[model samples]
Target: MEQHYQLLRKHIEEICVLTDEEWDVVAQRFTYKSLKKHQFLIQKDQLVPCEYWIIKGLTKAYAIDSNGKEHILQFAMEQYWTSDFNAFQNKVPATIIIDCIEDSEFFCLKWEDREYLCHEIPKLNHFFRIKSHYGYIALQQRILSLLTETAEERYNNLIKKMPKLIQRVPKKLLAAYLGVTRETLSRF
Candidate 1:
């Protein structure tokens, strides 16, 4: 957990500069946790109590379709945030699952704690607002891609955005993300 602190501090400072004293205040609110490969951080239909920031490793947020097929909504790597946003925001049951893809370590920031911190540190409000804006833009692009892009095009776009990521994920998971069979992803 001590080792994870530096990474978390760095990520936050990149978005909003913080003095050491301010950082100490910022860090104190987070709870450190670790998860093994395939372990779930948040499961469908459960209440999401916190949002996680990855210190190391990978996770995927996904939903199981009516046919029991998994559809990957997002893959979060080091320095990324993972959570069922609707559940977290509304205090409702989760509609998706967030699970580790590898042995992972991260920090969890509870909703009430986040709200408190943001109010205490006004800069944090700006920081989160910027992050939320980007999240919206990315979601829009994803929706557009799903609506109109071919699987190969989606693969190419992912490659452009996250070249290192494609190699790390299993082919089957990549296929799920692309909304295609493994064979189709391999062809791409």
Candidate 2:
């Protein structure tokens, strides 16, 4: 547990330098959990009061459409943080489900704990806000690209931008995220 706490501390340090005492306070609020593949970390439309940091393994945030098609919104791998933003920020039920794609270890902080950390550590809040800002910016870029770019161009951009994802994530899911059919993606 101490080692994991140190890992969290190190990750926090990357975002911003934290004093030893501040790191201790931040680490104290997290608890670790292991999840098996195909397990639901969070279910769609459920109230999710916690956000997670992936210590190891992969998780995906996705939603099922009316036609029962799965649309993947994002993937979180090692050293990444993930949560249903709507539920975490607005205290509303989640529309996205977070599922483990591989056996995983994660450190989680509940909403109340997160609030306490933010209130107590302004730098932590700034760190998370930066993350949020980057995420929003990426989402906006993806939307604009989808609206204006050709499918082949999108595929090439994805390959260049997220090469690891192309290698690790299933092609079908990657295709869906790119708004191209699996067959189309295969050709690219």
Candidate 3:
């Protein structure tokens, strides 16, 4: 899992100036795994045990609608973290599914380990608080976009944010994420 440590170190370094010692502490908590395409990282209605940091390939967090449609909430690429924080926090069953879109490698950390970080290194608390704040803001922005933006607008935004995913994610999945039909997405 040295690769996982390196990836985490890079992310921590970007977020805050992490000393080698601090990085070591973070590194010790990571567990690495390889996932096949279409396999789940976190399945719907299951308890979230860990949060993952993507080291390779792609993954997405989504929810199934009442009509059995999958609505993508977020996508993670290399260096990104994916998890259902609500379930992780409350020890409740997850309402979302986190699935790999490709053969993926990830560094995972359990909830208890994160709590230890806060207790062991106070600076990490600041770092995590900021991370959580951004998560909240991003979620809010997504909700607003779903309410205000047209399907084409959402699709265009997705391309701007993750241009590669247009070719990587299945077209039907992409369309559902953007609240468009597959034919409409194809036309665009």
Identify the leading candidate in terms of TM-score. Answer: 1
How accurate locally is residue 128 in candidate 3, as Cα lDDT from 0 to 100? 82
Task: List runs of model 2 lying over 4 Å from the truth.
Answer: none
lDDT of 3 by residue, 70-96 (tens): 788987888777899899889999998
Q: List the residue pairs that clash in candidate 2.
A: none
**Tens-digit lDDT string for candidate 2 (68-114):** 98887788888888999889878889999899988989999998998
lDDT of 2 at 9: 83
Lowest-lDDT window of 10 residues in candidate 1? 1-10
lDDT of 1 by residue, 1-188 (tens): 66789888888888899988888889999999999999999999999999999988999999998999888999999988889999999999999999999999889999998998899899999888888888889889999999999999999999999998998899999998888999888786
Sorting all predicted structures by TM-score, with the top scorer first, yields 1, 3, 2
After superposition, candidate 1 runs with Cα above 4 Å error: none
Best-first order by lDDT = 1, 2, 3
**Candidate that beats the other on lDDT, 2 or 3, i.e. the better one:** 2
Whole-model lDDT values for every prediction: 0.91, 0.87, 0.85
